[model samples]
Target: MTVHVLEPACDWRAADVADETRWTLELSPADIAELEAALACAKARAADLLDVTRDDFPLPSLAPRLVEIEAQLIDGCGFARIRGLPVERYSDDDAALIYWGIGMHLGKPWPQNKHGHLLGDVTDHGKSGADSTSRGYELGGVALPYHSDGSDLVGLMCLRKAMSGGISTVANALAIHNELVRTRPDLAALLYEPQPYDYRGEEPKGGEPFYSMPVFTEHAGRLFVRYIRPYIEASQRHPDAPRLHPKAREAFDLVDAVCADPAFNVYMDLEPGDMQFVNNYHVLHARTAYEDWPERNRKRHLKRLWLETARLTDRPEKFRNFSSHWAQKRTKSELKLDA
Candidate 1:
């Protein structure tokens, strides 16, 4: 949905990842029906707003219904298993096209994956090497180490898959927080403190090349966590970030352990055309890397989305980029596209 008015004043506040518990809402006939209607409405509305044509875009009418599904994904039951969308019926690049359309109804598009990014399996550099964007390479290949990108929610729509070894994994951030707060309050306290983060050049013009916020925050009794340790650690490269206390390091380690726990996570094998979205602030997601047998033509490719669902929720004071005083409050400035 188009933001009615730009929220005046750039608060530049980012909210903490809240500790709201998430439950899987299974896909049902009723849910599918609702989603179809919403998607159809959102498509028409979005196309109209963009001043696009029905024939060129091939959009279905799905706005109101899309908003309903988006609300459910954000605030109601956490995550849902949705089915019967066009995504479930196709493969190849066109399936990726459908995902971009559905995502518009769900949340604001992300910067780097603005509108959408091609979710194809190609030989990108593994942890041991650099990234390659070759077509027919492993796109969305599983076995990737656990990590989260900058998005309120991530929608993954399956278009094709590797013959084997591409299971998706997700860990609940709340579970990790609860365990730490109960067993390691001292460490948890550090997470609650402001932490310095590398801007990665997303800062506003004239702003410093970095910002500070905590890995976790709490507001209205909800726990919110946002962690990309690699980025956090990179901030140290600036020579200005505060030194992490020994206790703080331990807390980070503890949180990592919880995320690795099988008990607090779920595994998914995305089917052709199935779209799955997870709350980035509440979930830590990863994939099992796979070896693609290119000779057989079985490859992995999926479309990805970074969404911002305006779920009127409270977060810890430390999360300022999304809703904090430290963040730019303009909702948007230049639409960086690279984010």
Candidate 2:
């Protein structure tokens, strides 16, 4: 099978983004004051985060900057770090309010997982990565393999840092695609074919326990990739799931090898108050194993949001309006913030 080979606008190497100045946006003191003021107003009105709108938490000064960020996420490097939120001064609830408010300007919050959780907690929930039903975010102290989230964009706001390790890494999948096309076009072609993926126990009721999606797709002159090696391997447990093709396995390995190379990955030790946003289609993210503080208050924690951006005019049919999980919509539920 042959695939169209086009130069992706998001193609970028780690060296190209090594300078923090390119992707890091440090909020000014005024920006912090504005955010705090909005948080205060929202608190005063007892506004629920799910109900809060951009108009409710206005960012007169930061709104334009967010628009710029939206552009950068789509047309530029596909990932960014917004630093300086003074998270230490506020409680986790307050910090989440601020993060959710900021996220409002970027895009509409989509549900994370089968649960209709517009807001998600990224702290470890005692899950094991080795378990077929375990989600990486729910498993603590384990290194997450590079993978894309099911959303147009994914954002994480750091509330606490781990005692050690847990550095976040992002790789430019567009660059990986370009490299594969240049070096192993045959393997790259295999990626465009559908591959089986385990649903991780979130399978639709009365439906198959697995689903099929291509690792790479090109739509309207754009490159889109959805890769999760662990899930693909786990699908083998289901007797009814189609077996993975050997060529597809080779393609997965090639992509994994390219993503692991330092030449393609940008590593960042996310600190308290750091907010990171990545275009899920163009970037693959991972986290290193970490040791957490014994104290619950000091344990590593981050709030996450999966957003559907208005910037993309077109996307693969499976991704449109969260169609991939349409059959499982009845199971939608939101995760509550820990007290």
Candidate 3:
């Protein structure tokens, strides 16, 4: 396969964003008022969080800003942070509505897991990272390696901050890919080959426990990435899964090494009411291990959304069908909120 190279539209480095101002968009008082009014309108109409639509939660003043944020995710920096919501003034339910409503303006909600939850809770659920079937979001107090998620865009709205640590970091995968091609074309080529990934016990009935997808894909002149090392490593537990090639292992290591470099990553501590949105194809994100309050009510919690953006027109065929089977067969039980 030929190595595809393109102009750096979204390529950025840590030094490019030395201050939080680069990625942050603090909402104005009018913006907050508009959002609150929208929420009030939705509540008056008896709209459930799951049932609320962009039309239902109209953001007249804030809609333009949301548009700009979406553009930044697709074309500028691959990530954007919107802060300054009065999270303390609202109940958990109301805050969730505001978040969900804002997300609706960005993109259509995509299911996060096999349960087909368009909206997901990101709090510790007493899961062990050592377990082959455990997903990173299910485990608490563990640092996550930089990796892309299974969506065009992924968003997290922080409802509560951790007691300590849990700082969020993002690395520019686009820049890393370009650097790899310039420095190590051999290693970069291997990333285009299919790699086995574990389904994390969410495999469809009668389907293989593992699926194959390339770490990097080039389609219609755009670079798309989907990397999750833990899932790839976990695939080894399945007897039928293909063994990882030695070259593929080297490629994985190289990608991780590049991502871990301080020059490539930007770290930020998410405060309550801060909403972060990232382009899954261009940015790889991680979080430092955190300590949560012992009291359940005081624990760190963030709401998550996987989105399919309108801006991203063409993608690899595998991505469209990435989790289509499970999504089609999803039941009401899978849509229920676990938290």
Q: Sort all candidates by lDDT, best to worst.
A: 2, 3, 1
Clashing residue pairs in all predictions, respectively, total 52, 1, 0
| Location of the lowest summed lDDT over 10 successive residues in candidate 1 | 2-11
**Tens digits of per-residue lDDT for model 2 on 1-339?**
776555466788888888998898899999999999999887776656677877888899999999999999988999999999999898788889999899989998786776657788888787877777888778788889999988899999998889999999999998998888889989888888888999999877788999999889988888888898899999999998889888888888888889999999999999999999999888999999999898877888888988888898788787765565642432212333335
Give the better candidate number (2 or 3) by lDDT: 2
- Residue 264 of model 2, lDDT score: 98
Candidate 2's TM-score reads 0.95
Per-residue CA lDDT of model 3 for 249-332, tens digit only, reads 888998999899998988889999999999998999999999988887778888888888878777787666244665663221
Q: Pick the winner on TM-score between candidates 1 and 3.
A: 3
Off by over 4 Å in 1: 1-72, 84-93, 113-143, 200-209, 295-298, 313-339
Instruction: Quantify all predictions' global Cα lDDT against the true fold.
Output: 0.53, 0.86, 0.85
TM-score of 3: 0.95
Compared to the true structure, candidate 1 yields what TM-score?
0.65
Error of 1 at 228 (Å): 0.9
What is candidate 3's local distance difference test score? 0.85
For candidate 3, give the lDDT of residue 204.
82
* Predicted model with the maximum lDDT: 2
